[model samples]
Target chain A: MSGGVLYRPGDSPVHRIPPQVKLLAAFAAVLGVVATPREAFWAFGIDLFVVLAVWSVAGVPVGWFARRAVIEAPFVLLAVVLPFVSGGPRVDVLGVAVSQDGLLAGWNILAKGTLGVLIALTLAATTQPRDLVLGLQRLRAPAWFVTIATLMLRYVDVIAGELRRTRIARISRGDDPRFLWQAGAVARGAGTLFLRSYERGERVHRAMLARGWAGHMPAGPAAPVGALRWVAGGSPALVIATAWAVAAWPV
Target chain B: MTASVAMHLSDGVLDASTSVLFGAVAVAWLAVAAARGRIDVDDRTAPLAGLLAAFLFAMQLLNFPVLPGVSGHLYGGALAAILLGPWVGALCLSVVVVIQALLFADGGLTALGANMTNMALLGTAVGFAVALAARGLARRSRAGLLAVAFLAGLVSTVAASAGFVVEYAIGGQADVSLGGLAGVVIGVHAVIGIGEGVITALAVGAIVRVRPDLIYLVRTSETRELVAA
Candidate 1:
């Protein structure tokens, strides 16, 4: 449940940019990348460069993106398999037979998926978790949805700690959780965790009630976003748009 | 399991049009789930749903061995539905999907709708309906309840994978054969579904023994069965 913020503390201008703007920019960049057809290879290249430029400006290391990009590992595997199994005209690559369409398809997934992951990582790295929540709230996501997501993020660490403690106790008692034979214990442990979490929720509700809380989550006044902040946060997305425009321009 | 449990697709997996279309579907689903959560008879449903969302995220970290080298964790769609009825369960799962994409780079931000529609909507609701039907067929025994959980997990995984196929059929960017993709995806998930079934049944069985009341699926019916016994 590594739900902790990937935000790196920095004095860079990227950090100072409003999270809502950053969020919008991230979404727009991803859409820009996704919208560019696979044939529009130049737009994809520009998208990557824009993301990297922002990355360098933000001062986040390449290692961070590389490590987190492993989340895309399974998809990369899917991409690799596409060429061999895909039904299309076969093309030879270094003496190996491959589907021509599959190669392009694989490349499409690789390029766009990679850029999407990078842009997401950049936003996660530069934005605080609290600000992310605030951004969601300010963006007028359903109040209950925001509240639940915020609360879940808040308690993920706590529940994860509980999991760690439980696992430690189990290991000390000679339980190997990784093996299938011990799945019964794992399931039971999960059940126990669920029970404990549910009860904790009850206690949390009582505490909230005691503090004069209502059913509704109160959102504080949001700070205004200026034109300058939008421009600052939107620079990379602007790059993506320009690249898209160039590709779309009548030749 | 990674394909199924970590169900969110990275960006560009589906074309932008398909992503936006599914995103609209996801938003509408969330609004319905949110509205239902707010107006539910139980006042504590919201907080409970919130904590359950956290619980599912935590449970995901604990993976069980599924094969010679494969392992799978709880996808929690069926588990959530059984514990907290469909609407709240869907909302809870949606929250997890949303957060996983946002904070963690686990899913694509642009693909959020496709991910959400598939996992939160399809993965959850179908499992719940099946489990409810299974419960009726199996009647009021401990074995029956476990069977419901098993069926729920199986149906949920298969259904969710099928959903991926549907989305892929609509806007799959890959030039791969849609039929081939569907077969491979569903085949993998069927095996994954067995492991899901076992874990889900056992997990639900454990809770049924301790606190049957907490599981929304069997709460009243199970209570009635216990009294008869």
Candidate 2:
């Protein structure tokens, strides 16, 4: 659980910027990048430069971001298969004929994914998980969604820790779970966790009722984004706008 | 599942009908939840809900490769519903989808409904029912609960795929056979479901062990307090 990076405290410029701006910028950048066509090599390059710059400004350690970013690389697996799977003209490369469309699809994924991950990483790196949710609500995200997400985040660590212990307990008992036939122990562990989660939810609900929690969750006034922060944050939107316009025009 | 995936807004494809339909559905769900008083408005719950949605959104952005050509993201709709109850869980999941769409453009605005219905509603509702059944059958035994979770998660993933099949039949973009697509979709997803079930059970189990009180899905001792009173 500790291996996964949560919020680490830092005084970088990103830390000082309002979470709302970061939140907004993250969305804008993602949209801009996604809207980019596969052919816009220079557009993707510019996006990469901007994301790296933001990462630096946030003062998030390069190693930490790099490690955390690894979580997203799995989606690249889709790109890998695209060439073989997609129907189109084939090009011979390295003794293998790959679909030209597939290569384009891969580029599309890489570009969109890299930019998407960068935006997400920036948000995750700069803001605490809790603050990020608040920003979503402030940005007009629905209340029910916010609640489930909040609880999930709060409990993810706890649940993950429980899983670790359970695995350890099983191993200590000389259980080797590698064989598919030996999965019962792991399965039983899963059952145990579900009951605990169910019981826990009930308890939490009662506590909520006691505190006058109705169904709909209320909002909080965590500070607002500053003007200068908006300026800095809004800069990406301008860049994206420029790119979008260029992409939109007939070449 | 592909259709359902299409239903949920993704980056490459954008269509007005899908966007409008999805957006409307999202709004409608919120309205319904609000009317049903599912969204708990309080100092503690609201902020936490929003936060959870945000976290889910972020976590989903981090997809892990599950196969040579496939990757998996956090599909926590069922887990969330089991913990928070369907009302809250659905809201939270939809929130995550909406955020992903608007911010990340991960899902399309038009296909939001299809996404919500498949991932949030069908997945969560089906998962909750199965989990509840598991709870009842196990008499609150932890082992029983996990088994239920495994079954529920496994079933729900397929169900989500099924939801897509039905949608595709209705709004078919291609002339492919529904039977063929359904078979392929369900087959692949069933395999994926094992991973989903295991990961979900493990995550939920770990939470139940330490901070069982924090898990919204579990019934608390305080409910007994009310029953005693």
Candidate 3:
């Protein structure tokens, strides 16, 4: 189990924007992409441009973004299946009739899904995990939710390291996870790992209480978001909304 | 097997109305879970819940081979519910889902609500209930416990798939008919469900053998029976 995060450390302007604002901006951009008509291909182009502009500003490599965006491969597989199975007026392509509506639907899924993913990737690349939790806290999310999220971010890597060790130990003992017959042993290893994690949690809780931990996680220093940060953080969403409004306007 | 559950519904897959409806339902479920004190954690339970979220995240990364050229990973809803109880299980899974979407880009941001509802809310609730019912029917023998755990995993995956079908029926963007889509989705998921069941059973069985005290559902039920006696 790798760290399972995509955050890249940088001091670019995009990285300086507060995590909450970037979160909101990402949300707004996704809404814009989803709301745009599929026929408005130019709107999708504008959305991509916005994403690229952020990528460039953040100094994130396009190859890096592309590599991470492969997580959307499953959705792409679903999109490829849509054109054949979907019912619509038929269009001839390479002597085969396919649903015209399905093609549009497939394109719709591919374009919008990719855009949503790109925006999210930008957010992840620019925001640190701790800052993200802090951002949630500042946004007035529930205290318990923030605390759990904070602890989760803090310990995810630790548990992932433990998992790797467990896998290695299993392999050294002749257990192979690749064979279906070995699934029982693999799952037992997972069970042992869970029990160990449970005990570690208990011990950590005790240590925290011994050092003086109240019911709530203590608040960190207040860092106010300036208007300039909002403007910079929100530009991608602004571009996307403008593109949608323009595309939707009657000639 | 290489196949895993559709972790998240992507944008444009469903109509706006359908997304909003499912999103609202997910939010309502979260509120209910919180109101029921399921998300609440004391000092002792808080660390456990957090570590459980991390553990789930790690486990999902480890996919086990099921069929040739296909693999499956633990959704872990049944395992979590058995160990932590349903409410905390739901919360922990929700946290993992959120982090996956945000950090790993494994799920769509807009479809977060639908994903959470299907995986976290429905999976944990249905899985836990099925486990309890199966346990009751099996008379709680050692083998019976393992069998129920397997059954719980199977039912949870099927239930989550059913949830997707319902959402697709309501707000599907593609032109495919409901029956046709449901048939394929449910059929493929049934196989995945078996993998889920096997892994969940093994995990539960191992824990039960070593430290029965850590199994929350078992502990609570035994205490209830003691009170009745």
Candidate 4:
């Protein structure tokens, strides 16, 4: 079962910045990186450095962050093989036919994706989950979208825990999930889970009405965000500027 | 099918009108989910929605290699439908896609509607239907039920991918052969479908044992059966 690593309270400058600033800056940085032309290799490298600097200010443990960031490994793996796939005039690399265009495309993806993931990781590691949702809501993200996200985050663990218990029950009953031929049991398990989750949503909705819920969800007190507060709190704009300059530099 | 299948299509591939059309559909679906019955927002539902969105987001980030060259990511509609009802599942997955598009740029903003249709509406609707049919035939047999779930998940993914190919044919930016490219994309997805099916089934099976009432699709079955009896 996949679990979320929520933000723990800390005195770090990164933790003190309002969620909105982090959200905007991180998104802006990602956009900047992705929009960078194919020739901007240096710019991508500098973006990486800026992201790392954010993690440092956030007081995130490098080891723990690295482990958590491993979630991006699959995407990274895909990027690794990209240069070899799209067919073109092949360049000899260790006696292998690798497409030069594919390599460039792969590099582009790897840089942007890696930068995006890191920015996200830094944001998640430093900010509380609720704050992130709240920030999104404040930014005019749709109410329905925000509300649904809030609920999903809350109940995922409860449902996941239940799933684990059920799996154990099935295993104890001599169900060998490992056997591909015995896939029927696995299918049933999924169907059964669906039924349970559906019913739970109904039940949860009833409970809300019983407690006097209105059509729209109410937001918390708006937090005042000052420019200086954000600049010091988040990674500086100069870092991004430097990265942009590098990305624009000659190949 | 290559393992690194990009769920997000290029902007030029889908015409502007098509994107807006799908976007409207996605919005309408969410509106229906919001307007249905009790407008009361439950504490549990909201939190669960967020977490599930996160789970889906994270899982999609971890696109596993299904075979030698192809990779697949968690599309999440079928899985969400199993855990949350089709209406809510559709809403959740679409939101996830929107978030990815806006925040990550993994999916283009212009084609957001099409992505939602492929990953959320079509994926969840078809997956739920297959699961329902499977459940109907295998109501009495545990093994039969599992088979149905497996097939449902597998078929749903292929159907979703096929929908992409169709959309591409309609709004193709390149000179690639429509029928041939569509076939290739769908064929590879068929194999990737197994992994999606297994992961979805495994997740579903785990949840059902603890709180059968928590599952959206299965809950319908038990209730309907009771009503019939």
Residue A10 of model 1, lDDT score? 93
Highest DockQ: which candidate? 3
Q: Residue by residue across A1-251, what tens digits does model 3's lDDT show?
A: 12556889899999988888988888788878887888999899889988898899999999998987887888888788888988979998789888898888889989988888888898888898878777777878676667678777877778778778877887898876665666787888888888888877777777878989765677778788889889888988999989988887888
Error of 2 at B68 (Å): 18
lDDT by residue (tens digit), candidate 1, A5-31: 677889798898888898999999899
Docking class of 3: medium
- How do the predictions measure up, each by TM-score? 0.94, 0.68, 0.94, 0.69
Clashes of 3: 6
* Interface RMSD of every predicted model, in angstroms: 2.1, 7.3, 1.8, 6.6
Candidate 1 reaches a DockQ of 0.62
lDDT (Cα atoms) of all candidates against the true structure:
0.81, 0.62, 0.80, 0.63
Fnat of each prediction, in sequence: 0.71, 0.11, 0.65, 0.16
Q: What order do you get sorting by lDDT, best first?
A: 1, 3, 4, 2
* Cα lDDT of model 3 by residue, B1-229, tens digit: 2333355777778766677777788778777776565345455555667878878877887878875676767888778877777888888888888877888776777788888988898888998999877667534687988888888888888888888888878877778878988888888777778888888889988988987777776766666354223
Instruction: State how far residue B66 of model 1 sits from its true place (Å).
Output: 2.8
Question: Where is the poorest 10-residue window by lDDT in model 1 chain B?
Answer: B36-45
The alpha-carbon lDDT assigned to residue B212 of candidate 2 equals: 58
